[model samples]
Target: MVNLLPIIKQTLLITFFVMSMMLIIEYLNVFTKGLWSKGIEKSKWKQVLLGAFLGVTPGCLGAYTAVSLFIHDIIGNGALVATMIATSGDEAFMMFTLFPEKAILLNVVIFTIAIAAGWLTDRFFKKKFYIPASDKHFHVHEIPECTGFPKNTFWHQLKHITPTRALMLMSILFFVTFITLDEHLASGSFHGILKWGHSSHSDSDPLWIKITFFTVISLSTAVIFIVNDHFLEKHLWGHIIKRHFSKIFLWTFFTLLLIALLMKHFDLHSVIQHNMFWVLVAAVLIGIIPESGPHLIFVMLFASGNLPLSILLASSIVQDGHGSLPLLAESRRSFIIVKLLNMAVGFSIGLAGLALGI
Candidate 1:
């Protein structure tokens, strides 16, 4: 078990490194006065192309940042969604790191689907939802100056890559380390507890105890983000986790507890172990539940070689995760409707891919 610690640490470190690189690139784009247009003067097709390209980026936070930029007229909406679709979330990186071959194929299939879907959606809504007014156009004579960049070359780059940024990256690396380590510890603890309880105890323990335990653990994990303030910065870790802690915790606890209970009550580990597809289906269904953080657990599970089916299914469904929640939270009804629509679209695409053996 201790041998696994280094692997976990490396994974977390890489995750942080990837996120840091993304932030540096984005900041560079801003400082260089590249793609700084209050609005891009590209055609709809060009925007769609940009969106598709953005979709292949690592995570939804990157996609959302792109989306928000477009929304504020830094970019356009069509490109934003295209990028969103292309993004495979942080979990994809974990997946690729752990299971390179499978992850690569899955990502390619998903990226292709996202591009097609984003393009169609953009076109469908452009006429009615995204009508551009004549007065909305703003073309500056020269690119806007980057106030954030220093005049000196080395200092300019260094300013964007500060100690604060380094700390932020280290913090995410710590988080990934902690999560992986905690899981191993928790698994052992749970197994021990269950074994001892089974031998000595009666079946009826108060439901309240279980519920309380679940709630406390869930809340504690969720609140960890608060103490880890660096996770909230505009860097990759920060952007990904900013508003997603609660949703991820609640759903993950719910699923984990439910699975635990079923395992205990039926003594059916073998049954579940044999039927990987059902687990995959469960993971996928959970993915569609609308949070990014919990879906990451699916990647962890994949890394640990637990439920491959579930990991694959979950990865397929939970594309944008908590990144999409803000958009949904604006209106409960719309959120539900759009989420369902997205799931349906995603499922159809995934199923088709699976059927074709792609």
Candidate 2:
């Protein structure tokens, strides 16, 4: 029973971070009107290179931006494939944060593979869009909301707190407080709660950078309180915070908790050490998970010298960060097909690397 406390704290801690991230990304997605990738879809290689560049940018933004473009018919299937291949997911940022040199090297390789694979997918699929918005099966919830400043004074606007704004404010405040308290209590005890290796950005640099960043973000939620009804409900609340935060928070918590429980009972590192097949299989299987957070396991294992380069490469190739989330939300069929292709690529590369001793 006592073991449960740290687990809960850690889970909630990660949930808070995930929630904050969703809030920011979703807000930006709404802010940009989802048309940021409009002018780049003119040529085949142009689209592929654009996707690769976006994918290699080191966050969900790249993938999400790709999804936005694809949904609007601004990019095609090949570009979509390229983006996913290039995207290292959220784990890319963490890897870069932890070991910049290795992550950068892996990213360069990924970028190269992504460009080639994207072009191949384009040639073979021979389609403009894998699952176009017109396809009866693939649907995106289109909420077209306009934004402009309201004609109210600042103090008067401060008095206006919608349910969503209040909720956002409270969540931000709770996370800020949690971070502040965690820093003071970070011993090896359960109260220290954070699973350093299990989470992202575990570099020696003062984790205080994270705290301060979130602190500024928490303060920024005041915008929610003051923004007019249209911007609040349509842009901030409906488009981003309400739509994404809860889902991301839930996924983050469950993935973390499940990984924690599994690691506790199973010696995964030992299980994979003697068996090349199991290592490759596990790498590809975990890669199939659509979310970016879970891949941190393979990364931390690699960083600790417990996992091999080839296996890590397999995971890196197969995983698409959060790039798949919009696809999963749009068309499960397309998402499944993409994952299958990536699995094949990952296995071939992983096995070939193992054979060549590379």
Candidate 3:
């Protein structure tokens, strides 16, 4: 029972970030009237590059951004694939700590592969995966509520906050408070709750992560404050929270918990210790998981000289941390396709590297 606490904390953190990104994107689309969407729609390669760049940014934040962008139709299947390929999830941080020089090289290779793979996916498989804007099957709920600023003053709106508004405010505040307290605790006894290797960043949380968290939370809070009753009830609460919250939370929690159980009950370490062939296979298979912690085994093994770069590369290429959980909620088909594509790429490159004795 006690073993599950850290998993809960991790799930909460992932859920909060995913929800915040969704809200932020929703706010941007409403306010900017899809200006950002229009820009990305012009060129496929442009979207692919943006996705790779975001994917390479440390942690799962960039992957979350890419998923949000894809859901809003600001990007396509190719770009999402690119983001997943380039992203090593939280394992990238561990890699940097374990083997800085090799980590740099590995990331560079993955980035290049991500770009190529993304461009190829768009060129060959675009039509098969393209979800038209009018496709209701893949559409996010669109409430016909007024999205303009409330006629009432901010204070007036605050005073008359409805249940939905109150709920949203409390949820965001709780997430913020949890993050603050977690960081403080992480610096002391709970330092490794979120990490396996020593972090390269000076702070408990990365600087850019702090910046992104605060910026998005601020925007979301401001939106909650000024949006009218209809928008709050229909769009923010109904569409964003009701449609997404439980799915993301449940999927993330169960998936992480299942992986934790597997690692605990199964003697995977000894299995990997025996054969290079099985290790390569295991690396690819585990990389299929949508969580982060499992991939760190490869990182640790590589750092300890017990695993080769080829296996680690394959694992990194296929696994994308908790970044893909939102996509899982949005469209299971898309998530499967992305993972299959990544697996193919990871295995091909992994085998090639092994052949060359990398």
Clashing pairs in 3: none
Instruction: Name the candidate that leads on lDDT.
Output: 3
| Residues 241-282 of candidate 1: C-alpha lDDT, one tens digit per residue | 343333434443443444445544654446646764565566
After superposition, which runs of candidate 2 have C-alpha atoms over 4 Å from their true positions?
53-73, 87-109, 123-137, 141-146, 149-155, 183-212, 215-228, 234-251, 258-266, 286-313, 320-337, 348-358
Candidate 1: clashing pairs of residues: 38-73, 51-82, 55-86, 55-87, 70-75, 280-309, 280-310, 291-322, 292-322
lDDT of each: 0.47, 0.67, 0.72
Q: Compare candidates 2 and 3 on TM-score and give the better one.
A: 2
* Span of 10 residues, lowest total lDDT, candidate 2: 184-193
Q: Please give, for residues 188-251, the per-residue lDDT of candidate 2 as tens digits.
A: 2221233434543432334554454445466456556556766767766775566555654555
Q: Which ten residues in a row have the lowest lDDT in candidate 1?
A: 189-198
Cand. 3 Cα-lDDT: 0.72
Model 3: per-residue Cα lDDT over 1-358, one tens digit each: 3377777876676666666656655655455443333477778888998889777766665687777778767788789999999998766755553355677899999999999999999988856453635534333323222357856567887887787888889988887787777754344312233342335345454554455557867987888887778767866787678876776667656755654564567554455556767778888999888987667667655654556789899998999987888788777888899999999999998888888888
Worst 10 residues of 3 by lDDT: 137-146
Per-prediction TM-score to the true structure, in the order listed: 0.54, 0.70, 0.55
